[model samples]
Target: MKRFQRIAGYLVAAALVGYFLWFASSNLDIRVLHELLTPPVIGTLIVAALAYAAIIPVTGWAWARLLAAQGESWPVSWLTAVLAVTQLAKYLPGNIAQHAGRAGLAMREGMAGKSVAITVLQETVLAVAASLIVGVSMLAASEPGLAQLPDGVRPVLAWVVPILLLSVLFLSTVHLSPARLATSPTRAMRLLGKAGGLPGARIALPALAAYAFNYLLIGSGLWLLARSAELPAALDLPLITAAFALSWLLGFLAPGAPAGLGVREGILIVLLAGVGSDGELLAFVLLARATTMLGDVINFLLGSLWLSLTRRIAR
Candidate 1:
C-alpha cells in the first residue's frame, strides 16, 4: 500500500510538471525566446537570478535561529547548502522529500532528529504566515476599491486563515518551555511522540524579520524582472511585491501543484490585469520562471562549493 501510494505521488508530480511546461511552451514563440536572449536582457536576468538566490541565506538564518533554540548550532554555510540542494526535491512526487533531506543533514551535523523536525515545522508555518502578513498588509494599504481578489482566490484566502492563526499559536507556545529539549535525534522524536514541543525566543523576532525580508527579496526580483521587460511603469513597486507574495501564497497553499504550477501563474496574471497586453504578461511570467530556474542553478552551485570547501577544511 505504501509503495503504491509513493508511486501515485510521483506520477502526480510528473503530470503537474508536464502540464506547466506545456503551458509555458505553448505560449512561447521562437521570436519571443530570441528576444529574451538579447545580451542586455540576459544581463538583467542574471541579476534577477542572483536576487532570487539571495533569499536562501535569509532562509538559512531563520532556520539556524530555530536550531539554536534547541541547544544545537550548525554553520550557516552548512544549513544553506542543505536548503539549496534539497530545494530540488520539492519537485519530486512527495513534497516532503526536501524536509527529509534537511532533517538528515541537520542530524549529520549533530542536531537531534526531533529538533530538526520541529524546526522544519515551525519554519514552514512562520514562512507562510510571514507571506500572508506581507500580502494582506499591502492589499489593505492600496487605494480602496482598487480591485477585488478573484472569486477562485477568495476560497484559498479563507482556507489559509485558520492555518495562520494556528501557526502563530504554535510559535508563541513553543518558546514558553525550551529547557532540556532533547539530547539525540531519536530521543527528540520520542519526546515529541509522547508529548509535543521544541523551542526559541530571543532570536525569534529576528527570525521572523528574516523570513519577511526573504519575501521582499523575492518580490524585488519580480519587480526587477518586470522593469527589465518594460512592464507597466504604473504598476508600482509595492503593488508588484504584494501581488507576487499573494500569488506565491496561493501557489503554496495549492496541494499537488508542484511549486504552485498553473495556480501561481494564473493568480499572478489575474492580479496584474490591465498592467499589460496578454502577450506581454505571458512573456513576463515565462521570463520570471526562467530567471527563477537560473537562480536555482546558482544556489545549487554556490551551496555545493561551500559544502565542498567546508568538508575539505574539516578533513
Candidate 2:
C-alpha cells in the first residue's frame, strides 16, 4: 500500500511539473524577459537572493531551540550548517529528501535519530502553522487582491479561516512543561514521539514566531523581485507577500513537487493575474524562481564553507 501511494505521488508530481513547464513555455515571452533583465533589475535580484539565503540561519536557530527544549544540546551554528547544506536536497526527486538528509546528517553529528525525527515533525507543524497565519492575515488585509482571486480559489480561501482557528486551538493544547519531557505520555507527545517530549510553549511559540518571520523574508524577496521588474506601485508589498506565502503553502503541501517549483509559480501566476501584463507576470515568476535557486546555492556554499573551516580548526 505504501508503495502504491508513493508511485501515485510521483505521478501526480510529474503531472504538475509537466503542466507548469507547458504553461511557462506557452505564456512566457522571451523578448519580455530580455527586456526586463536590466542592470538595476539584476542587482535587485542579487539582493533578493541574499534575503532568501538569510532564512536558513533563522530557521536553524529555531530548530536548535527545539532541540534544546527537548534536552538535546547543539550549537546553533552546527545546526545552521546542517540545515543550509541539506536544504538543497528538497530539489531532489522526493520533496522529502531535505528532511531525510537533515536527519542523517544530524545523526552523523551525534544527534539521536529519534530527537531528529521529533524536531522534524515539530518544525513541519510550526512552519505550516506560521505560513497559514501569515498567508491568511495578509490576504485578509489585501481585499483588492482577495477580490481578484478566481471563484475556485475564493472557496478555498473561505475554508482557511476555520482551518486557521483549528490550528491555533491545536497548537495551544500541545504545550508540554519542561519538567514532563521524559514522562509525558500525552497523546500529542506520543504522536510526536514518546522518547523526546514536544517543546514547551516557551520554546515552540518562539520557534513558531521565527518561522513566521521566515515567510516575511521570503515575501520580501518576492516583493523585491516585483519592484525590480517595475511592476505597478499599487501591487504593494503586503499583497505580493500574501500571494507568495499562499502560493508557498500550496507548493509546500503538494507531494513530489521539488521545493514547490511548478506549484508555486502556477499559483502565483493566478494570484497576481491582473497586477501586471501576462508577459510581465510570467517574467516575474521566472525571476522569482531564479532568485530562490540562487539563494539556495549561496546558502549551501556558505554552509559548506563553515563546516570546512570548523573541521580545519578542530584538526
The sequence of per-residue lDDT tens digits that candidate 2 reaches over residues 173-275 is 5765534654546666554346444555778788988988988997888787788788776466778777788787766655777788787887787778787
Worst 10 residues of 1 by lDDT: 175-184
Off by more than 4 A, model 1: 1-29, 141-174, 178-201
Q: What TM-score would every model get versus the actual structure? A: 0.77, 0.87
Measured with C-alpha atoms, the lDDT of residue 166 in candidate 1 is: 60
Give the lDDT of residue 278 in candidate 1.
64
Superposition error at 126 for model 2 (Å): 0.4
Tens-digit per-residue lDDT, 41-116, candidate 1: 7888889889889889889988888877767788786788888877776666546777787788777877888778
Sum up the clashes in candidate 1.
1
Q: How much does candidate 1 score in TM-score?
A: 0.77
Q: Candidate 1 local accuracy as lDDT?
A: 0.70
Q: Identify the leading candidate in terms of lDDT.
A: 2
lDDT agreement with native, every candidate? 0.70, 0.80
